[model samples]
Target: MAANAISPVAARWIRAWLILLGLLVYATILVGGATRLTDSGLSITEWQPVKGALPPLDEASWLAEFDKYRETTQYKLQNHGMSLAEFQFIYWWEWGHRQLGRFIGLVAVIGLAVFAARRWLGGGLGWKLLGLVALGGLQGAIGWWMVASGMGDTDRVSVAPYRLMTHFSLALLILCVITWLWLSLRGAPRAAAPEGRRTSILLLALVFMQMAAGALVAGLDAGRSYNDWPLMAGELVPSHYIQGDLGIRSLFEGRAATQFNHRVLAYVLWGLSLWAAWRYWGGALARPFAVLAALVSAQALWGILTLLNAAPLTLALVHQGLGVIVTLAAVYLVWRAAAPATPSPVQE
Candidate 1:
């Protein structure tokens, strides 16, 4: 082995740890969706990095936290009469979301430290691990930034849709990088199919863009606004989608318009996935291509059901969770298309 290259065994351990971290990030996204859906994101008004790990431990502490929440615009305007027990319910969700984030960071840091101390991380792996940690820290700051956007006295009932999208997009980017790195470490290098790789990359980008649009839908609580399928507000396209001078801005700010955009994007992606399935048929990429099509089609159905049912908690969470799966499937196709085609005995 090259002197600077990571050992096969050490690389395996690092990849396993990264895969675990990626899964944790996925879980965090699901919990975050729940937090937003349940209107629990702003239950804790302050962002205490170290001290906040311990949730309200007793009655006094609980009251103090609730008092802070009461001062928020959301609590005053939306949940004015909510009880302490009810507050606790939401509080736990938000706390758990934050706690899971902290745990992921801790695991990354500890793993990096252990591997470095043992000189197990080589071939730029240490730098990759460090970069992941840095990105995680930035994400935490962005999380608080998103939460603070909605806490102002004159702010909207929820976080700004742009910030919400930024936060969600960052999470997806981190997950993609981690997953790509993990897959890169697996098996051996193979020759990339240029045309197939190009198409897969486009598909992956579109999936990400669709997820961002979905974030806007979640941020604006737009999913519950129109509960019909194939049409919105009794029209093929909504009529009152524009409220102000900026008709383009309405896509992000207007509930009807946002939901409309999300629906259209879904249709486009669904069509594209079907095309991918056909293009990759009877090839090495057939299985992942099929999975991508199935997942996207299922996700589209779930989205419609969620909207028709007013985004019920369980269905909504599942809908959001499926986005991660679909994104990863697209990513898997991209990886396979780009990877070197050298045959390796350890191929998974």
Candidate 2:
């Protein structure tokens, strides 16, 4: 082994640590989806990174927290006359989401510190790990920003759609990066296929765009509208595709427009995935493309079901979780497709 190389055992330890952290991040995303679905995101009303770790302990503390939430536009306009018990319900959800985030940060920092202290992280891997930690911190800030949008003096009853999209998009981006790093540590590069690599990259990009589109749909509660298949409101395009005065912004803000966009992107992604699967069948990229095609098909179907059912909590979360899985699959394909034709020197 080279002087700077990380031992196989050390690499495995680092990989295991990353895998655990990745799973936590994945859970956090799901919890966030649940928070949105249940309208619990704005319940906390404050971003106390340290002091906020502990939820309201007694009735007075709980009421104090609830009192703060009562001032938000969402509580005033939407949840007016809500009971204290009901308040606790939403508060707990938001509190859990934030607590989970803090836990992830703790685990990430501690793992990096331990690995670095033991000199297990070599070949600049320590810096990469540190960068992920930094992104995690940024994500926490973005979460608070998203929550703040609803608490402001506006007619909005929930977080701004664009900010929600931004926060969700960043979470997925971090997940992709973590996945790519984990895949890199697997060792033994496969022979690269340029054509397949290009296709894989295209598919990954489409999947990511579709996720962002889905976020907009969730943000605007668009899936609850036009609950029909093949056609929205019995037309190829809804008559009110751009209902709001937001004009071009309607694509992201308008319920009809956002849902329409999400549906269109899903169709495009589904077709592209199937095509890639067929094109790469019996080739080096066959398995990954096949898995991608299957996942895309399932995701599209679930999405439709989610729409038809008015985006129920259970189905919506499942759809969102499956989307993450599909994304990880795409990341894996990209990593595999981009491998060097010959093995490269292994580093930690």
Candidate 3:
């Protein structure tokens, strides 16, 4: 018996498909942020995975959906007096978000099916695609879970920040996997020195942690609370960071503490990015390292502008998008650093 194998051309096409899927996921993140910022996630009020993709096609359907939303705490507490037209505005954002997720899942299933039918899934290709499908399914559940957190609680208008963070973190995890696989399929470069690889890995971890902190900041609406950059509420450190019941919980639940920690982490990440670029200046990973430095610097500026401007929609979206870009840069750096020492000839 012979081992099943795909041609190089087929593999390239599959990788290209994965890249496109990855971009779609990135777009989903941007849209997701917009939905959250606009308070649209809870507008749907129900999770209909199969039937929900079509959305409300007529006035009657729209009214029915709006009626369901009226029952949610988000509508009662935060969106009271929201007219039907205003309700539609948010409905579309959440609907489109779900539709996109469905489309991504559809595309993944179709890609895997077509590849398998053609015997193009070889060398663990099938398992990889299956794993992504599983993750995508989990993300859908997480999305609903996040929204459900705020649904019945009349005291809360937004989903728990921690749940929102978990949703975003999983999305990033999926993105990172897709990105690394795509980079690996492109062509393996000569591996970096052992010390360089270790440092790059460390940088990647720090960047991820910083993004999680940003999630907490978003969850707590901490950015809106402190409009000052270099200082928060007219001080280097606000008077009361530990105002919550538990000392440790303040780090995650307290707005002031979360925002303060996010700022501190951003500065630390910036410093580390500079060091990464310096360390890799003459190595194979130099390009990615430099790109990471530039991205982190721009991200810092964006964060400040978004903060000083009170996180206006446009700037806040840009800030979130740049955070994704920075993460991609870090992932690329790690990928390059971890490549085996033997280089494949750069393909055309």
Candidate 4:
């Protein structure tokens, strides 16, 4: 509202909207974690944008669905004869997850319409917005892909590990892009990143990879297995978790060894980030690197605590939620460090 503040151009407005969308996505992810913990992810079993809104209007419909749930292995082995109230409890978390997703899609559509109409968005902004819209639509398809993993299988009623990781990765990808666009709009670009700061961008990529691995750990329920501290399974590095499987299956297996790998990776990431921070401290990169290091350290501690506490819903969700925030901060650092290509000059 102040002069020279430059009313947010449509491009900037869309970017700001995306940052909010990113927050909402992370909140939904937290709810999704709850849904898994409560064993409610498959409660609905069907994707209905309109029809699903009406939940079992009468007793007959409710019992019919309850009976179907009973047929599943989860009910027979785990929840045997679960009460209607108990079922309803888990149902709400999953339903809320879906509803939140619906809300995100709605907001994106509205924002796209309003921004385009005003011509406030310019250059590549329009095309990029279209790409983002497509990705958002694809996210829904992936959500169902994850749900379908559990629906058709009897051994597990939960989503597949790879699919779970992929879903979370997309969410982070969207968040990072939106954050960068917003920074660009706000004139947050560095006039010139101090020399040798380029490695900070490399560090950002490594941090994101570490995060994807973290998601896999969550998906496979791997955290609950590797509870030992300082050393995994009594040894400085447990050798058993990694030796059991071959190729990628080994990565997703709910074994202490696989979880141990995640542990070691976290430490490696921690040390690398600390070194990066030190390098930054003496130069122009100091501020962002120090901030990134602080976030990662806090995140690592939260991660260890979740493992020690047996992955309670609250602790686990917080770890997952903070993963997004910290990752975005690292992205901002990377954008500042990397220089874009500019026009070339010629001599006559």
Say which candidate scores most in TM-score: 2
Model 4 sits at a Cα RMSD from the real structure of 4.6
Model 1, span 262-292: residue lDDT tens: 8888898999999989988888788888999
Question: What tens digits encode model 2's per-residue C-alpha lDDT throughout 224-335?
Answer: 8899888888999888887657888888899988998888889999999999999999998899999999999999999988899999999999999999999999998998
lDDT of 4 by residue, 164-223 (tens): 878878877877776766666654435557464567766777778887887777777777
* Runs off by more than 4 Å, candidate 2: 340-348
The TM-score between candidate 4 and the true structure equals 0.89
- Quote each prediction's TM-score: 0.95, 0.97, 0.94, 0.89
Better of 3 and 4 by TM-score: 3
1-348, model 3: which lDDT tens digit per residue? 235444667768888889889999999999998998888888988889998878788999989998998888878878888999999999889888898899999999999899888877765667877898899999999999998888875577888888999999999989999987676556435455565788889889999999999988888788888898799889999878888575888888899999999999999999988987897798777788899899999999999989998888899899999999899888988876774543332242
Screening candidate 1 with a backbone cut-off below 3 angstroms (N, C-alpha, C), the clashing residue pairs are 190-340, 190-341, 190-342, 191-340, 191-341
The model with the greatest lDDT is 2
Error of 3 at 115 (Å): 0.9
Kindly provide the TM-score of model 2 when superposed on the true structure, using C-alpha atoms: 0.97
RMSD of 2: 1.5
lDDT of 3: 0.85
Which residue pairs show backbone clashes in model 2?
Answer: none
For residue 70, give model 4's deviation from the true position in Å.
2.5
Could you give the C-alpha RMSD of every candidate to the true structure, in order shown?
Answer: 2.3, 1.5, 2.5, 4.6
